[model samples]
Target: MSVVSTDAIDKWLLNRKWAPRDLSAPPAGSDLAPVPGDPGMPLLGHSLEMLRLGVRYGLKRYETHGPVSWVRAFGITIVAAAGPEAAQVVLANKDKAYSQQGWTYFIGPFFNRGLMLLDFDEHLYHRRLMQQAFTTDRLRGYLDRIGDVARRGLAGWRPGERFTVYPALKRLTLDIATDVFMAADLPAADSERITRAFIDTVRAGTALIRLPVGRWGAGLRGRKVLEDYFRRSLPAKRASDSDDLFAALCHARTDEGEMFSDDDVVNHMIFLMMAAHDTSTITTSAVAYYLGKHPEWQEKVRAESLALGESPPDMAALDRLGTLDLVIKESLRLVAPVPSLVRKTVRDTDLLGHYVPANTLVSVTPWVNHLVPEYWPDPRRFDPERFAEGRREDKVHRMAWMPFGGGVHKCIGMHFGMYEVKYLVHELVRRFEWSVPSDYTVRWDPTALPIPTDDLPVTLRAR
Candidate 1:
């Protein structure tokens, strides 16, 4: 059984003094209800509580304030929009009111002007150009190349009693991202340095104290390292015809022949690397943990993988692994790697009955929405069958199981990310039998994306 921490801290959040509604008043004769909720623990608000409690914190807010509420955290007030109905509104963005400005509150400095941070026409235009890189022929080439990297990446693992899974997978995914996205094959020393830089920047997203200290400071420095490296490397990437994403971006164009600027190429490369590496690492680790805890599912998935000949399964083969697909889906719902589909409204909007004003930071809370009992059965259980054809609880609502987010800004690399996870996990189950102690539960750190604070140890045995 999984244990969720709800001790003194959880109780404190449940009973903390509430904050009054601060959403700006709607223009005259407007009927949009004011957004609501408690601001936990005074000035610090729900920040620490959120980092400590992940979904448990989100669940409590859903129960107390319903779909839309205000959360004071990271030194700002945010409209914490939750549930499928609210998700539909924000992701669809019918009025064009939501922009990447919400992400500006956090990762804008690090990932600024990358695809995810652009708004409306600019975003659509950039996306149209970027789409050239992910074409079907290009993805197949990426898969073939990534297979070699995955094999080499995992070749170092040996049977062990307490293998630290998260870090190892993190390193491997960074290698994959570097090879497939940037096409730069660096020496071990450089790869290690760049990997550390990525980690610092990712963790810095949640750093409330923005200064020349701690993770935030490291992130600032990391950004400089990347900027210098990319700027220096851009001339070569531009001159080449390499199949990697770096060259693809440098060469991609609309039919009208508009292409990325040098700065655009660098910005997109930095942000895409983070998006692919961190989220995949988080999702893969979650799947590994669940498969370890539930060996029956693991064995069934192994059988499916073994049934297909082991010589580097292609995209078609990866798609054919039914059991593994279910497991990945279940894992994604449980973890919600991206967690929040962030946005900030450009103007006033009614979010599921709440009055949210212009310039308000609003987010569609996939972390909380994925756990709502109305759309899921036994929201905390690890039942892959919830996604199996007959049950198909994900169909209960279009936004219910949206780990990849939705609408225009839905993850551009999602298909690629999914294939990458399936490929890695497929290879893993083929090579080893892994398990976790019956009592083991990941204590996730929500300081950034929800990652395991304990390193996620598991036992590994070669098959």
Candidate 2:
């Protein structure tokens, strides 16, 4: 081979589409060290590179600038902190330097006043009220209904040569969200429209432009559609004693005699429903893709599911899915559904000794932690055994394997999401044999939540 230079490789990876710029110097006599980074391009920054490379782009930044650095992307300067150490400082937030205000610049319009958008005492208050809906008893009830919906939805799959799995999983999850959460009698067309609306609203958050003609406009309209639907249904939910999530929210209360208002109920329901279906779909799809690629592991999990019998696993039965659980955990580490979290510095702060100014956009990337070799050996491989009882690589660091994130903002629905995935995957392994070609691979589109660009097709056959 001809000569290949290190500089050439760095140039290609840092393509940035243009030259990198240095961030502003630290304030006079701040004592903290100045952070090193490349700002990436001019106006657009590294937005396009990020959209193209997904979490993989973080590697380029980390390799070039270490754990703490400043870079420009998506029309703003962001302080990027990678690996477990950086993740710890941000998630722990011992000094209260970061605020949820950072997300307002992105998703506030579509998910206004949702739990993740609130902060400090307000966030705690809302989280406390919402906790009533996810009690242990309610979870058992939700699991029962989820099994029913999972059976009905999965039964409709045709088992084709080129089965587009992601869309199918997406549809199944939305059905679960609507049926278990809403418990309303809706026409097929109405539910379909609602699903399209949720898609628009979520996609519009990062749209380059907000003109009514594109994803932005459609998202605005979608938000109205959802708000109207939930508002109209609010009266019935408040009046009835239904056990669904919607009614639960309407009646949720604390021991101190607190409850949600009409607007509070509506806002929460919209956000919870979007989170329930979309993220679950992503996690479940990842589990399937991994199982398909590694047939030995597929058969391993399949045998266990088959041993459990097919009568819809109860909570105890779900707990017995040890192999499946390990596989799910590994898939989560390899492909974090949310990947990175955003925050804004409320005051000046130092991330691992690098000075960051007030109001600066900050990103703590858990995806980076998942792949760092020190935390996980063979991190890129499909190795669920890393999470086995004795091998527990994830235990090396508290934040090393946070697929649902951590700290106070950790996902509220994570427990339910796990149960939902177990039920769905249990049913799937029992009913069919699936696989991808040995040479096949899928690319996740980073435009939103890292969905498969090709919709992730695989070969499906009836068991």
Candidate 3:
């Protein structure tokens, strides 16, 4: 594993004819126009800058070169699309020009054939069949498990000065996923191992050296662990008629008699499990950070949560927390769980008047778009009222606020994920009131999924 070098990976990729085409020449005297802007540095390109600045790098590039610009990153030239218009084009995918294969270059090794990785009719087919797992009845069952798990998890947290909320919330969400999705309660050691596996799998996407070295090697090992674990558990899930998501996927069928194979069930389970827990953890952590910064909003949301009584609120009751809903939306906008949506051109395409050739990687930056002043006024401010009835700023455009993505490939487990976050927050506010120092601001490490660099420390007082 240590023998594999970055240069070796690059050479291997090039030798296998899997490397991106070199688009160094200008498209002159042709009707099709070349994408404008600079590809920073050699080999590495703007990837280092992107990691350092996060969405701000895209915002800067957008400022210099219009909505559509080409930038080299992650060993390829990506057509960076900024603002809501670009998001509408890429996400809507009206012409069927874009393919989900772009994600294949990144996470496919770990989460291959996952729903997000499927394209065209195949994606629709699997999504239709999987819809049964997230129906109202199923979501309600998930909520029950979430509430019980949340209470148990929160009870363990010693409320006092300087608590790192992100890690606690991350662990809590993973536990909820294990119970609600897997329908099995493993011992603490096993649960911890599974959780670390998930973390490694996700973090693998942004490894600087794609070769099997250090963390990247662990990620490859973790993927195998997950594959073996899921394969081993498949028999039990299929034999039992448990209402958990694992069982649902095993038995899920469409009106047309479509059903997933055993392999399909295992693959989808791994992807869904990662998506369900990690995104929920990010959203919940952001909400906690914002609520801590703004006590007035915290008190307002807490009041709403308190009205629902002490016991865990059901899915229906959870929806009634309007203020909390606003906060969640704002938090999602602020710290998008999966910030940028990547797509590869299946054929030659025209995006915002710039010509993109086939097999090109196109990135639509929602994280930066969410902060654009034109779309979102006072973008940096933590104003949840932007999503309130009177404002409804998100309605400015169909793709303006796309934290869950849009069009055919929007997150299928969105409802369940939201319910999980709201339930956890409700339990959190009811049990303790937390706050961060006014002068402090979170530093998001955007290497993979956006996570706080400092683990999000805050002072917690028992209610």
Query: Best candidate per TM-score, number?
Result: 1
Q: Provide the overall lDDT of each model, using Cα atoms, as 2-decimal numbers.
A: 0.87, 0.86, 0.87
lDDT string for model 2 (31-108, tens) is 778777776766767776676676778877787778888877777888888888898898888999988998887778
Query: Across residues 344-368, which tens digit of lDDT does each residue of candidate 1 receive?
Result: 8888888886788888788788888
- The clash count for each model shown is 0, 0, 0
- The predicted structure with the larger lDDT, 2 or 3, is 3
Q: Model 3, residue 396: displacement in angstroms?
A: 1.0
Question: Candidate 3 has which clashing residue pairs, if any?
Answer: none
lDDT of 3: 0.87
Q: What are the per-residue Cα lDDT tens digits for candidate 3 across 148-175?
A: 8999989999987889998999999998
- Which stretch of 10 consecutive residues in model 1 shows the poorest summed lDDT? 14-23
Report the error of model 3 at residue 66, Å: 1.9
Candidate ordering by TM-score (highest first): 1, 2, 3
Q: Which ten residues in a row are the worst by lDDT in model 2?
A: 13-22
